[model samples]
Target chain A: MGNSKLYKGSLNTIILKLLDEEGKMYGYEITQKVKELSKGELNITEGALYPALHKLEAEGLLDVEVAKVDNRLRKYYKLTKQGEKETVNRLAELEDFIRSMQQLVNPDWSIQ
Target chain B: MAISKEEVIYIDNYLKFLGVKYMDIRLEILDHLASEFENIQEPTSLGDFLRTKRSFVKRYENQWQKAKHWAHQRALIKRIIGYFYKPNQLFIPICIGIFFGFNATLLPKSLIAISFCISLIVPQCIHFYIYYKPEGIYKNIQSAKYILSIMALPSIFMYLMGIMAPIIKESPTVFYAYWFFAMVFNIAGLQEVMTLKRQIVKTYSKLISN
Candidate 1:
């Protein structure tokens, strides 16, 4: 798991990347997916997840669908057309950050 | 394990008790809580687990109150831009501009002035409604009121220009400024009217209670 502070910065990108790969997802599904992907090392806390989802939805980068699930209404969020484009840009930007971090941490090896 | 129907009803009641209205945010909060209950590794009653999860109350409250305001402001701006792509919606605003453009010369000057004042005052009244009835209003409607207030800016400017319109009416170069301002305001008012803030609550009897 990465540092909490480090993960916070990439939260939006992580969400966009996830929605880019997976179809629409609800809030809990998203948190669980992130935990699964990171081997339970990175917990996308609810405080962080919900706010990011709302912000992204407000920014027109996400679309929302309200459906009845388990006798309750669930909000399913997916990337918008603009969001799809943003995923590419954000993923590229994150990859660049990872490469830079690798270079900084492993000075002896060529940064991939 | 799935949350039982009774637990779901209790959660709904608790959320309502905590003042979580907006159907969208309320539903999300409920879904998250239910999903969390299912994932609890330890054998714990759903109600017991939920009782300790203070975050639910805080989240549901913050989402519709503070976060909702932020999202509303952003949505207003984005929707304005989005209007461009939806020509059907764009057509109404453009039609308003065109109507005022041609009518400025034909309509009585007094009537034009009256419209300018109405445009300015209507939005002010909307702000007052939200302020007056802060409670019992849906978050969607409240934000819609705020949007009405925002879209009113052009009308405010148009009202300000009413004084200047007559002075420049004779000049060919600047005569259209009044009409332009009027059109901008009219378009804004047209948008706000859709929010139904002005209509008496009695009139919208079919409207679902927020």
Candidate 2:
């Protein structure tokens, strides 16, 4: 498992990227998806996932729909039009960040 | 491994006991907890699962409460500003501004006081109604109350500043500014109330119907 602190900065971008790919996802599904994708290396705590979701929703970058799934109400979040646009921008920014980190940590690692 | 409705309610009660009292947050937490329980490969009692997950639940509830405080403030401001830019939503605020402008000179003190009272009281009434309503989705939603209080703030401020009445009477500029702000805020508040009601109704309509 990677250090969680190392993943913290990219969490929102990661979520946006996931939603961009998945269309819509609920809270539990999102955490599980992240864990599965990272092979359990990056566990998104419910504490972190939900606040990020709520912040994005507040920013109008995400939209939510509530549905009765099984015996409970589930809030499913998806990218809004703005969110979709933001995902592209955020992904690009994260890519730039990764390249910068790679250059700083591994001088021999050349992407070009 | 699907959780039963009874188990869902039990989880909700446990969350409440853990200080996650807001219905909306509690509902979301309950769903997450239920999902975790559903994923368990081995048969486990609800009590055991809750005991194991108590720390996580407490952590989330605390973080959510903090995040919600800021999110509520930001969303309220965003919605209020967003309301004016939408063409369809422009009508009510325009009418309010026009009405106040037309009546500015002729409007008596009693009428102004009454207007302020209405603006102050209406949002509160809506909040109280929803908060106390049986099975109302917003009954325990803290954001609803937070938004309503924000909506009422302008009225409360203007009312308290009735001390400005003497100054307002002497300066038409001040009076105009006062009425303009009052008109804008009251109209925005009304719009927020409508939006909040629409959201609650739309989000929970299925549950209501069931």
Candidate 3:
């Protein structure tokens, strides 16, 4: 698992970015994707993921649809129009943060 | 292993403790988990299934907590809004009485006295409403503020009018009436102010304690 403290801040962005790419995903699938993308570096527990998803859904940022997948009804969440817009904004914010961090770490280095 | 009913009840109580009030939502979650467990056709240990279910419940509980918090906040706001109006029902009659009382010269003295009687009844009615009707702390606090505002309006109007125009000629009777009205106004205003202060202190203390 990635640093719990660092993961706390970035989890929402990570979820949004994933939904932006994948279109729609179930709870379990989201957990798997995060692990795969991070090469198992970041392991999101069910405890954290569900609450974030529900909160985002409540805030009108995400829309949910439940359907039977392999005879079991699975709740899938997709980014709403608002969610998509939020994703772009969050991504830009994260990118800017990363750039600033890089500058701080290597003050002598300059981007080409 | 088949999931027992007791396990389901345990889960239900846990969710309730976490503030999940909707029965249908809780049942839906339980059904989903039960189905997942049923799908494991091969004999699996109850302990393993319980472990897996625990993880699932934990994930969903996080979402429930956020949603519940939002709901609780919305409820508090609604209760406060309700309080603003609960006391206004009393203030209206008092206002009408004061208006007609001041204009008694244009009407019968009996009518003015009747209006005063109605005004007195209104405050008692308000007291009954405040006591009998159960309200949340936020709502009670808000009602107190509303009552204060209502009390201030008449005094403010009378004070301004008295300063601008000496409606009643300077006499001992008129002076006594003026002092009496001023006392009533002050008492009503102070009652509301004190109530509001009490509510504010209680609310702040609750927030701090939490």
Candidate closest to the true structure, highest lDDT: 2
Best-to-worst ranking by lDDT: 2, 1, 3
Candidate 2: TM-score?
Answer: 0.82
Worst 10 residues of 1 chain A by lDDT: A65-74
Q: What DockQ results do all the predictions give, each relative to the true complex?
A: 0.41, 0.67, 0.12
Counted clashes in each candidate structure: 0, 0, 2
Candidate 3 lDDT tens digits, A1-112: 6468877888889999999999999776787788889898888876677678877875668876655444233467899998999999999998888778778888677343
lDDT of 3 by residue, B33-105 (tens): 5554555778875456655665565456445655745533343334334443767545533664466557565
Kindly list the per-residue Cα lDDT of model 1 for residues B1-210, writing each as its tens digit.
Answer: 778888888887777777665444456678998999888898987667767866656665556456545554454455556556777667755776676676577778778667656655665565555545657343433334444444545555545665775666668446555545544544544454444344323322223332
lDDT tens digits, residue span A1-112, model 2: 5578998999999999999999999889999999999898899988788889877886778998878888888878999999999999999998998888889999699465
Model 3 RMSD in Å is 13.8
Query: CAPRI verdict on model 2?
Result: medium
Most TM-score-accurate candidate: 2
The interface root-mean-square deviation of each model, in the order shown, is: 4.2, 2.1, 9.5
Q: Which residue pairs show backbone clashes in model 1?
A: none
lDDT of 2: 0.75
TM-score-sorted candidate list, best first: 2, 1, 3
Comparison by DockQ, 2 against 3, better one: 2
